[model samples]
Structures are given as C-alpha cells and as structure tokens.
Target: MDLGLRDATVVVAGGGRGMGLAAARCFADEGARIAVFARTRTDLDKAVDDLHGRGSPDAVGIVVDVRDATQVERAFAELADRWGGLNVLVNAVGPDVRGTVESLTDDQWRTAFDDGVLGIVHTVRSALPLLRRADWARIVNFSASSTQRQTVSLAAYTAAKAAVTSISKNLSLQLAPDEILVNVVSPGSVASDSLLAWARSVGVDSEDPYALMAAITEHFGHPAHLPRVGLPEEVGPVVAFLGSRRNSYMTGANVNVDGGTDFT
Candidate 1:
C-alpha cells in the first residue's frame, strides 16, 4: 500500500519519541517530508536522524512545548517558511498526569487540560492555514481507549483525551468544506518507553510486551481480548493510513486500535 504519501509534508507533535516517533517512521518509510516537534532537543535530533535513515527526503526536528500557544505559533511559522504548506498533522502529544479525581490536585487537572486539549487546539489552529494550502489535508489526533472503557486511576488522562476526541469530531465537520479530513485514534496499552517506566516503577519489572500487558491488566484493569500490550510499530500503520491520501472518505471517526477491547 503506497498510501500516496511520497513528498507529502507531515508534522507530528511529540514525535521526539514513543508512539509519535513510531508514526513519523511510517511516514519516513513512505518518503515523506517530515517535521517533528517536541520539548527535548536531544530526542528531536535523534528522531530527525532516524527519520532520515528511514528514507524521509527531508526531516527536521523542532523544540516546542505544545502547552504554550505562543511557542506553537512560532514553530508553525517556521514550518510554513520551510514547507509553505502541510498535508498531514499528527498530534501525538499529551500530558502524562495520572490520578483519580479526588487524589488529583487543581494544578494537575489544569496541566492535563492545558497540555492535552489546549495543545491540540494550538497545533490545529496553527496548522489549518498551511493544511488548507495543500491539495489534500488530514489530521490524526491521538486519544485513549480508557476514555470509553473508563479507568478509575486514569480519570484525568481519560477526560483530557475525551476532549481530544470531541475536538477531532467537530473539526471533521467544520473542515469538511475545505476537504480536510480529521479523525481520532484511541489506543489501549502499548509498550512504549514511558509506559515501560511506569510498569517498572510499580514493580512490573519486565520489558517484554506480554508481561507488561499482563501487569497493566492486573493493575489498571483494562485488559483486551488479545491479552497482551501492543507495540509502537503495531500502531504506526493505522496512523499512516489515516493521515494519508489513501484515506479519502474516513473522517470524524474514532478508530480504536485497542487489541479488541470489550466495549468495541
């Protein structure tokens, strides 16, 4: 599947590492021009080099914190100067705060919304003009499956992702006339670095994907029918397809990549 992504310009927020980096690699494999933005310069530089090795014609990494609208605007301005237009925007950024409603502080709640929801707003708004300049445009925003399944410990995180899903749906409708497609991807447990660290912090002490999933299920109670956590590579294809010209008619949909969740 070519996905018609060659020469397409893509921007992946939080693409310095983890699932965002995985998705950027997918685009790079398709020979896309890629720009990845994140807070860490070191991670961004490494990601850029990896993308080039993966076959991206051009890969640049920007250091920007999505929670800050001013920084996001400046970064997008730089993108416009480099590419002049954008074909796809993959928002894989989110706040890592976790806690129950009662346990979470007011600052934590604000941080969650600011980084998760408002961050999406900042990126989408800044990218819209550039996306409109392209012949085909798509937005793929990451959500969480726990938003649907309802995890007590992930209340703040899930709530923030639910807002992301809502924003994507509304953007799909609002951007239809512009021929820009917007969609949401809700993922379950994936054995990414942050997740592995969390697992180890809780005494899971395993790097194996299945072991991590088992521990995750026992701790978080969000087990899937497949009985294992997914890998970052497993998610890249779905995001690539969604953000590619191959996805012509799908928009305003929340596609679950949750290893066969019970709710779906």
Candidate 2:
C-alpha cells in the first residue's frame, strides 16, 4: 500500500541504528525526505550513507541529543531550512538501561526518565510548529512492551515509557485541532545493539546475541502466540504507517507490534 508519504519531510530522532534506522529506511523507501537525528557524528554519517543507499537522495543526518531541548530546536530549525516543513516526527531516542527497583539508583532513574520521557517532550515541543505548518502531520512515539507487561528488572524504564505514553495521548488531544495525529508504538524484544548489551550485562553470553536472547525470552518474555522474537524491520513498517498520511482516523492509540504478546 502506498503510504502517501512521497515528498513528505520527516524527522526521526535516534535514527542512527536499530528500530529508528529501520523506520527511517522505510519512510525513505516511500519517497519521504528524511532527516535522521543522533548524538554521534560518526553514527549519523553512517546512517545518512545507509539512507542514501536505500534511495533517499534528500536524506540528511544531524547530531542532536534529544535530552537537550536546545539541540532539538536547532535540529528542527535546520530541518525546516532544508526541507521547508515537517510532515512526520518519530520520537525514537531512548536509553538502554535496565534495573530492578531495588537495584536502581536515583541517578539511573533520572537518566532513564530524561532519555525516555523528557526526550520525547523536548522533540515534540520543538517540532510542533513545523508539524502544524504541514498539510498532514503525524507523530509516532517509540515505546516498549514493558510499559504494558511490567518486567522484573525494568521498573525505571517502564515508568519512563509509561510517561511517554501519557504524553502522546495528551498531545494527540492538543494537536487534534490542527489535524496532527499522535500515537504510540510499542515493540517487543528485538535484536539490536542495545539488546545485546543488555543481555551481556545480565550475564547472558555475548558471543551469540540471538542465542542469548532466545534463552532469555524463553524464560521471561515468551508469549502464548508467537514462537519467535520480533525484528526491527517488522516494527518499522507499523511505525511508518502510524506516521503516514494513510493513518487518518487513528490518534491517541497504542499499537503493539509485539508478536502477539497479549498486552492488556
């Protein structure tokens, strides 16, 4: 299905790798002019090259930490200068920390909140003006399945993501008058660098990341319906749809791309 994203100007925070990069590639494939934002210049450059290879001639990468409102504003300003206006905003920046309530420190909680909750707040606030200027605008927020099914060691992370979910719902109501749709996309376990690091930290073997992930999932995350873990690409298309003009009637909704993990 054509997402009606051709020539649309899109901004994807944390688009250097993982699910963010996957979504960026999907949008670009549909002929969207993409601006991928990340903190590391090297990662941003690599992501830009990858996007260009995926047929995004107008794709560009900017170095911006979503934790900083000023950086987010600067990035959006640059995007506006380059693309004229924004049609889609994907908030994908998040910290990879995981800890149980007893094991988590105050600093860890603050850091996770800053990255997961405040980051979305900063990005959306900076992008609102440009989004309002577009003929059709969509906001897709990346959340985790943990928000629905509380995990043993993800108390802080889940709380932060829950805050993001609330923010998305509120923003959907606030932006509805301007015809901007805001929604949340919650993804299940995916094979990414962050996941690999998490597994290693938990004493899971790092030599074979997928094997470790499989073992962990079987013990903790195995759902009743799906027999395998989800892929970043699998989640990306859903996010692209939520951020596309094709999604006209959906707003303030939480769509789970969790391989049928019964999140209710």
Off by over 4 Å in 2: 200-213, 218-224
Q: Which prediction has the highest TM-score against the true structure?
A: 1
Which candidate gets the maximum lDDT versus the true structure? 1
Query: What local lDDT does model 1 show for residue 76?
Result: 95
lDDT of 1 by residue, 29-130 (tens): 998999999999999999999998987947999999998999999999999999899999999998788889999999999999998999999999999999
lDDT of each: 0.92, 0.86
Please give the distance, in angstroms, between residue 241's alpha carbon in candidate 2 and its true position after superposition.
0.7
lDDT tens string, model 2, 1-264? 999999999999999998999999999899989999998999999999988987688699889999999998888888778767799999888876778999999999999999998999999998988998889999999888888787887889889988988999999999898889999998877766777676777877655635655766766765525655567888889999999999999999999887676666
